[model samples]
Target: MPRFFCCLPLAVGVWLFSLLFFAWGTVLTVVGWYGVSSYERTDLALTRRQLVSLIITTSSWTLLPLITLFGMGAALARSPRALKAYSTALWFQFGFSVGAGAYFIYNLFRRNDGNFVTNCTSRDIADRDTCQQAFNVLRGVIVAVYVVIWLIEIWGGVIVTQYATERFQRSGGGVQFSNAPPPQGPGPVILDPVMMPPPEPPILGPAPPGRFAPNASGRFTPPGGQPQPSFVPTAGGVSLPPIIPIGQSAPQGQYAFAMPQNAHGPGAANQV
Candidate 1:
């Protein structure tokens, strides 16, 4: 829930409100400078009372943004990196709010005979009394503008503080940031005989048409009844290929080689 408050919506709302007040204040200031409604009906006469009103009205425009800046600073205190910028904006906003508020209250207590003192008095007449009526109207408008500035600053400040609190709570009173995962290592390579060995040579043997003849040893023998080559044996008990005797050729369909087990010991060859 606290996390939710720190979201963009609330932050944007605060910014917008602050912006509105500043913008409105500027407009009011410009209009007051152009000679407001009260000064239009009067003969030309500029007085200190009207001058003060004018200065305050125009100053209020500058004051709004000042207050907004200060309020924004207070709002953004959570982010150390951005604190300086936020603080600057907040202070600016505060300055504007205070200036506008104070001037507005000052004008409230001062006025003239039926003419609320205003800032739009003309210099056509030398007497200060002539400008009293116009100054009053200007004062009223300036006061309203200041009131708006204060309200906006208050609203904006509340939003930022509340959001900051919620965000801190959600992060266990700390800041939470996400980081990317580390990369993975490459896979190991495996070698298999079937996948790596070269293609094998085709086995050569006789055609399948002949019937095999058997010798006295019950082994397949050549057509002439000759003794056939036998399989040899090796130390590991695996049979080695069979081999034909000298001067003899293997019959069809027969691979003439000795199995490993059939091979006699090394010196046994000399006995034979």
Candidate 2:
């Protein structure tokens, strides 16, 4: 049901199959060494020293299969730190296995005096060569296992980095996530960029020469040139309509009326 189940098994299969193959080689190492150490070419004779080396060599080869099983499995670790540690460990194990395998092979051929004929004809040399070949085969197998394990490690690392990055983004903590979405707000008011106020219409009337304009005293002058004075204050301090003064009559014929007897104060003659 989980993706990990399907993918994890694929990883495990690769590692386990490698281990089984190496395990087979371990069995062959013991048999080959035992045969060479105990049996002379003519009568299967073995010295006690050769017997001890055989046991030690076979036992060491067995360790290779176990390391392949456990170390390769560790490459599929879920934790980032653990996976890194596993990868480092596998590398170290791989190096040690290579060195041990090379040394064992060297011992096998060197003890046989570089003669394949003698190596195969002598019981001890023949068995030693066989044991050395098995160790060599195991070395190759373990190397291949590590390669596959590293592939899985790389893939797993990528997944971890991606998952971690996504988690940080959701929490507003990652490089591309801080201030990602500003708090919701009403949008700015958009004024029309190219708009302008309408022009004031031209007023149609008489030309400037015929227009009425206010004077300094705040009286309006008619365009016809009439002198329009402002109204003056009366004795009661109230504004009176613009008219001739009491003592000063209206223009000679502008007003038509009879002069009263008291026109000249007390005894003035009445006049129409």
Candidate 3:
């Protein structure tokens, strides 16, 4: 019922691993039974070590099919509870694998001991060293096989766990992962030349004052004579703020102008 894309495939992978394990275990179980039968047919009775191996390996197949069925069914049905049960079964098998690996490694180390698995004390067994070497080699092979199975079990367990989780489900798409990335915001702002208003001309100096002059009269005029000034065009309109041109700078106390008419030093008031 999950929506993750990898759910179905990962479940199937787990199922396949279980199937492989069941088949391998069943084959080993059959081989163990055959070995026990072959030993029983011999005039020499089976050794205690051989008998123990036979008991464990022969009984392995009995429960493998049931466990495999559980895992495969859960995988196909996509049932979380069933998958969990299958994992629990695998945990027991994992325990067995660990025990078996330890036994084989120990057996390999003890191969040179006097009481080795193969009874070289018998008259027919002429080469005791050769027999021990062969037994050690067999134990090494079994250990290698167990190591491979351990890797497969780990991979299968992980796949099953992820498949059962909310992250992986049957619905299909390209790598359907959870939590989409946060929504992107608008890009940085940039000024456009066309949208900007044209720069106004800069102010050069204070505007010429407009004054009222006294009317022309022959009679003496009082000190409080009214004055008037004729209207004349001014050099600069100082009422408004100055605008600096692009790529140009001006001093704080001075305006940027090509020429100046203000007097300097002592002749500041003289027009000449």
User: Top model by lDDT, which number?
Assistant: 3
Better of 1 and 3 by TM-score: 3
**Candidate 1: segments with Cα more than 4 A from true spot:** 2-8, 32-46, 63-88, 114-145, 164-272
Clashing pairs in 3: 4-169, 211-229, 212-227, 212-228, 213-227, 213-228, 214-227
User: What lDDT is reached at residue 221 by model 2?
Assistant: 54
lDDT of each: 0.52, 0.46, 0.55
- 1-272: candidate 2 lDDT, tens digit per residue: 12333565434443444455456546746775666555555232334454444465455555545654554554444333443444444455445545554444444434433333444445454576675565456446745654564455345434333433343454555456365678888765554423532222222443243234456675545544554444554343444333333443322221265666557752243244
C-alpha TM-score for every candidate:
0.37, 0.30, 0.49
2 against 3, candidate with superior TM-score: 3
Off by over 4 Å in 3: 1-8, 40-46, 57-61, 104-126, 166-272
- Window of ten residues with lowest summed lDDT in model 1: 113-122
Model 1, 147-183: lDDT tens per residue? 6756766666565555555555555756656696777
RMSD of each: 16.2, 21.1, 13.3
